[model samples]
Target: MRGHPVTAMHPDHYESPAGLYLHIPFCVAKCGYCAFTSYPCGNAPPPDYLVALRQQAERLARHPMVREQRFATLFVGGGTPTVYGGAELGGLIRECLTLFNFDPEPEVTVEANPNSVELAKLAALREAGVNRLSIGVQSFSDRLLRGIDRSHSRAEALAAVAAARSAGFANLNLDLIYGLPEQSLADWRETIAVALAQNPEHLALYGLSVEEGTPFHRRSEQGGLALPDEETVQEMEDFAYGQLATAGLPRYEISNFARAGRSSRHNENYWHNGNYLGLGAAAVSCLGHLRFRQVPEPERFVRLINDGAPPFIEMEALPPAAAFRETVIMALRMLEGIAVAELAARFGVTPQDYYGKTFVRLQAQGLLAVEDGFLRLTARALPVANQVLAELV
Candidate 1:
């Protein structure tokens, strides 16, 4: 009787091998640019949080089909995954692995902030089987770091890579941001140069977008903060996109680049519309056409999970039409673009029937091209990608 409910949730819905995303919603100091749900450093999660986490996983495993499923990728991200220090983190990782079936060579990634990286801790994570590190080095300039409220120093961010290398982590990705309030094109070039000099396996470059409700947004609305004009921002992206591609880290997606074989498998799961399950407060999970997310408030999430539930605000089962639209939306985000056959299989509709008009219009505008069974956005249309995507939506 206890196992009956797990079987009824329908394992066929998660037909594809799933990916696991463990959100560590704890941070040292919140960055001005961040909007993720995370508690501050001093406010660590309650000590027994792991027991609740294990409970949730245990429940998931009780589901008949889920019991046998293995994850293709495992991503540990969040409010600075290293904020709790190594011992706590190691326990969480071990518990997760013990609870779920993992791929033979799952791409294991942990997001780290330079401020929290100690050589010993990094080595511990490595020894505990973390093969990839995604370091947040928002800027190499101390001036920009301070302006953005980043807790790490320029030296610390720089030294993190060296430290990771010393600890034997080769699959490293650096995160950089552009379009600062007082940054110049030359400064951006220098930033890019410094990042390239590190010879990272992958890099992610994000334009500074002040989301509504963020401190940056409020200040900008009050006219106290100045942002670069749209034209300047576009030019900045164009410069970086071209420069990075030329430097051999060609843009795989709009803002992400990888050196040869180092693309983030976890992120690719997102843009490619693959199956992924998220844990931790406010983390979202997508299985088949059903999407669910934990309540963003950490305490609330813990309470719900403690009550023997998934801690989500709601479980929304997307209709086939909605799912088709989403597939088109996410697929267009990739440089490899959407495959006709995959879309057809997922949506039960012909790509031509579903997106014929938008495809023709985009192609006539020289912004996209449809090849044998695939449709991809051209480099020219990438900066104005939203405009192109809106037509299909």
Candidate 2:
């Protein structure tokens, strides 16, 4: 069973960058539709959180496997990493650099929300060697922002982009959300237009999913949430594909668009099933066949680290076959899809060997296609890609 824990490491794995991910759990406030592991901390994280993080990083750095690896990318993400002052976040990155072996030109990225960022802070981050900025600008509509309980306004989002450029960040990514309650197709189109005016290097567009425990989910249960109809939502996605491509930002993945040479290397490593080390509360890591996550509660995580104990709350191992299956699924997320022969050579198993029947079935159904040497979803499956990919899993 996929859920059963195993202990063997796969012989062959991804030949891509080893990335590092640091999670910050504090946020100004939770979004109505957010389900991520985050807490509502007023302005910044508790003083002890960074201490615990530093302790955990120092402990992980001494492991034989970790010490031998050189990281190619580092991403500081969270509820909002910008909540910490630029100097504080930069200090954390500088410490990680000394503790870990990073590539000469590693891509260092930090996630921020417009409301929590300012020019001085951004400049400090740039000075600390952060080369990339990913700002959460869900929409440029004050009405939409309020509807989702977002703290930032349209003006703040625009200012954030200008500030990032002024701070000397050449690589930047902006996130936008669609299918919000009471959002019309016109509204989505306007948001995309506003985002394009910033000319960011990358754009991550996501459709809203109301998960359990989110305010949106409860509102939905009570039949109070108003969302665009399915057809309208599909049209919005199609429009974005054409619009962004026309703007020289082509779709590389289902939810991501980027200018040439600006795709997120950290996220690409993930899509390629490469190894990464994660730190901080609720952070997840995948090494060889071992996968685990830190304790979700920030307080408990800090206690564990302070007490010199592992903070992991969940751990699982993936057998080779299971790992290969996962690689295919994650690869399918990229528009380029999977290189059939290359993966087969690397894993010593063809897609046919593991999923021949499923492949034939989906291919016959027009949801998948093998073109040239790659196996990818068909154009017909792009809109319903999630459903099509789930069938393989």
Candidate 3:
């Protein structure tokens, strides 16, 4: 099946977003291990890019689907949103709230790098109605941080948290990465200890994956990288889960842990197959049944929008079977899993019927089980979830 064209968008065709995502593709410096669609902009973001962002926002607001829907959450993510300066970023956010209908108490989040955030910036974002902050503190170990080319030092990471607290931002998330070159178990433990001491409401712990085109990938291919062995990495993951749970932030997803009521609503929307509209360069939007991504280059995106053309570089209308497969894959990432009856109702086929022998075989191997009307991975399967999801897909 093919997705409908962008021209086919209508009020009735809208699958209302649970949230909105605005991507700021500019950063002061790109990290060696980063593969996201972000570029370096020294000192501050280009003024022209901000103007283009506004244009994109205006154009999106004019869409029938956007005009008719009220978003429940908003996430400003980036190369580093704080790089745009708090006042400028605040104005852009204010414009969005004015242009769209949002829930009275929407969960507004912005991603910040420890090196970029300051007390003044935090205050501006708070004044702009941002209630949540996801700060990238990658590691508290200065040595490990320098190895990964992180701009922030240990002191900066700690100070960022203090500043956020001082600015009256109570709901905070800290992002950490493990399995980096020269990152030992002790190093990870200390990082976790420092992060927990900050008392963030949420945490996202990710294992390092050296993506192609990243500097880390080249280092690995040439045998210059010294990443921990798989066993050590697994130990680190286990330690993190245990520590965070003890800290009262239980694991809510494979890579995320949160205190009660603090889970990321925007990300949960994605996990549950809820629709969202993304704006700005390199943003991806899934509206109705179509998935599309805007042009990645900032200049190209701005130029195309100025030309009155859709900036999308790729799009796909998901087939029913493909959609069902995706729904299962995403939902299974959560600890609660997916309801069997609900899946059957939506897709017109039960897991047993759709997956046939693969489903049954996984169950027999103790990797999957049907319990409490939901299909879920067993504890043993969580570590090898990729292999299990591969079979289903």
Candidate 4:
């Protein structure tokens, strides 16, 4: 297999520890707006699902490339990992630790939903070496949650946060969504206020998008989904940026905010365009210049693993120039952005040499700026970041 050209130039950078991601595809119920690959399995994954996952892990753990590099982070995310019983989830974590080579101070995280998680589950995860807990508290309003077809209520969300705190997790992240149907600026303010009251170390804010094939998409096509106006949604974003900054959880990435030293290491690895190994159905992996994803269906993925077939159904081998552009685009999501000098050092290609006329045009439009050696989006360009990024890529 051909490696990234930069790997020869900077061997240490390519050989450094990679992040690990495990997908839990089981959920209690599918939300109306969700497009993630998930099966509504009532609560936990089937027994055979875990067996297939273990086989995949063992296979990867024995690979020469995987064994050579230590892992610095492990993120367990899914339809709802907390749906599994406390003891069961704890055992899974333990098995992963024994099967992989991890950094001495790895940051292990698991995503949970409010209705599926309790104090006992939280405590068990903490004991199993999960230092970070991210709870999907999409909204604090019961009405908004119901409108989106979330299984959890406002009370359950609040209790989940309190329970995580009591379980010895000091590092916590809350996920929130803005611009729901019939939601107002005042409603968004209340949601942010309630989230702040919990004193979480990190916050992830997302705007609701009507994706294809979702119920929301169908409603939008039929003119039935009463989504907030674009202007009101923009207002909500502005308010959240200022409010969270004042609360000392400033925006570190476009959608992620963190207190000092609390940024997610696993996610940061991605923003840096670093290597990562992903296991389970629909999970994606990036190593060197190769990117691939497992089969989207859980049942199919399990069968493939058991049948001794490679689970990846799609793969891409990016050329050096494409990979360079990808790295820059991903890094630009960070608030501090990518260091122009660092890129030149690692890739031996300066932004001026690579981007050329496009770079000059964006900088002239005041949409992109180089400040203190970093190429970052200016405040004026933040709201239109998607457009700006498309131009770069």
Candidate 5:
């Protein structure tokens, strides 16, 4: 079954997730700004890690919730999923498919670093049913790429895209980062121009965030980082929006742009607050009112899975209020905004009733607006979304 067959109940009452996320925590080299739970694995992933992943998939497949579910999207994201051999990665995908009842046209996506991807790997992944490729082309400037300690050169980034095209990957997303230290507006503009030249199906543009414990954070604390000024960063964002729109890739979410009908289904599921099962080291899963997070350390993850025990380090059953807040926060990230009636139906409380005066005040400040029946951030409010969203919580 593609999904649980519905009875006479309203469709909204039968909400079930159709998405899955697999985390690959192995990387050739950790980027300076990255704080994700990933570590260097040199030439290839540890063989044991693959075995653990398969075990985890098999265990989850037997779970009652998983058995009742039919996934329509499977996203293999990572610290560089391409670090594993193509055949190995394909085998993992096949294993997941066998363990889960996936849709015939499920959107399977894999993340790759430009330095590790090749024509052979791309072909292997394509043959394995991966229809989309999201390449980590963080910057087109060689100097900026080095500043972030990225392993891929600008040439390698371009070559990776060319190879994916040759391998018949028509759906591709190039990830770009702005607000890097020493990144000028012109540098960002040139990066956008080069990325647009490739005509990717999607673009994920994110501003650099100096997370604590990362190398970038340490450098900033030591007064060594020279990040662009706030005004310049805002200009860079505006420029990207304009340039991407002109290239026919319009912004569907705050940080993502896509060609018509090409937006990431897996990501959209997240934005809609849909349920998803995540597997592998440090993976997170959200089903119904409960959320679970796996152990961050790969070795520990493998040990627990091999021992036939749950690898989760933490599990929480969200209170109603907390779930409502999370749903609103995620839904607001989309340009389309959230339907107030739907939100009320899902949460058992209208946004205005819950947020009360703060909601009205934000609307009065022109930071938020209610058009038709939807509540959304205004254009001026998007740049300061964190501040605006904080008010609700």
Candidate 6:
């Protein structure tokens, strides 16, 4: 059931975010595999996008969640957060943290492209309270990188990390992708080695999926691509998982891993159903019970917020049952699975009551088990998570 059209939630009913997320929707160029609403080399965005972001943050600050609680996690991800540069970007970020009441030691994170990470901009952000950086080092091999149309060279990524370290930014993260066309299991190994060599506090490794409307998706549809076979893809994933775990960054989620205390607390807020407000174009927010979408056009966002109103494109507040379903799907992404007692505590029903049949069926296949009253997926389930999550859906 849809509730009121409120953008902010009362913290007493909703789970307060240990973290916050701001969607920086500008990219220098969109990757072949990316379907997010990012335009590279397209239009010169107005300086007012930053103002609108601050408006969104300040608007939500009036809510009980922002007024009463402090954020433990803060992630500003994008098309490319670094595209905006240092002073301009830093000022906007500072405005947001103050509005949201984020903790001083919050895990502040921003997504960066290897091409975007320079010494000057990197240092500016560190001074502005950005403690973590997530750079897109999608592939180290120039051949594969060109195949994906990533903007950075392997050397640039390496140099960026060095620059970050020299700038006194120790909590660096590298994001990589596997399962590209013509990439061997050995190729995955080399990429992993290069990333681990950096000794980043966090790592995010994603399996390649050809999302609809993306350049990669179009290429696959036209038979212009040749993805690795499923067996080899599985083998690649398995090898990377084991490799990262051994390299001091263990797997924390199906597609992400980190060293101790670096498991992306901002994302963990999402996994645990923590409420967060998304700012900027195409940014999404789930606060209180209302889930809302913002306008995707940069110009439109500027115009709307300038009009003294948040330009929410869509919104939905969940009923208790729907919220329960959402919580199940989100929490299930963790290897820890869903906590049975916790689910019952929140929803007033056991896991067996809401999703008993699916759980029992998956358990019979040795893909799931209930241990200590928590439902968890086995390692085997991870490899076929799409299929497993489908059962729950």
Q: Please name the candidate that would achieve the greatest lDDT relative to the true structure.
A: 5
**lDDT per residue as tens, model 4, 67-152:** 87789999999989888888877887878888999988899999999999889889999999999999999899999999999999
In angstroms, give how far residue 170 of model 4 lies from its true place.
0.5
TM-score of each: 0.92, 0.96, 0.95, 0.96, 0.95, 0.92
Model 2 C-alpha lDDT versus the unseen true structure: 0.88
Model 4 sits at a Cα RMSD from the real structure of 2.9
Clashing pairs in 1: none
lDDT of 2 by residue, 1-35 (tens): 13223233343445565999999999999899999
Each candidate: how many clashes?
0, 0, 1, 0, 0, 3
RMSD of 1: 5.6
How many residue pairs clash in model 3? Answer: 1
Give one digit per residue, the lDDT tens place, for model 1 in 270-381.
8877777887778888876678888887677678778876587779987766666667778788888888667656555655566666666778999877777787888788
What lDDT would each prediction earn against the true structure? 0.78, 0.88, 0.88, 0.88, 0.89, 0.79
Per-residue C-alpha lDDT of model 5 across residues 96-156, encoded as one tens digit per residue:
9778988888899999999899999999999998999999999999999999999889999
Displacement of residue 111 (Cα, Å) in model 2 is: 0.4
Note the residue pairs that clash in candidate 3: 3-317
Model 5 RMSD in angstroms: 4.8
Model 5, position 122: C-alpha lDDT score: 93
Q: What is the C-alpha RMSD of each candidate to the true structure, in Å?
A: 5.6, 2.6, 3.8, 2.9, 4.8, 3.9
Candidates 1 and 5 compared: the better one by lDDT is 5
Off by over 4 Å in 6: 1-18, 42-45, 63-65
Provide the lDDT at 139 for model 2. 92
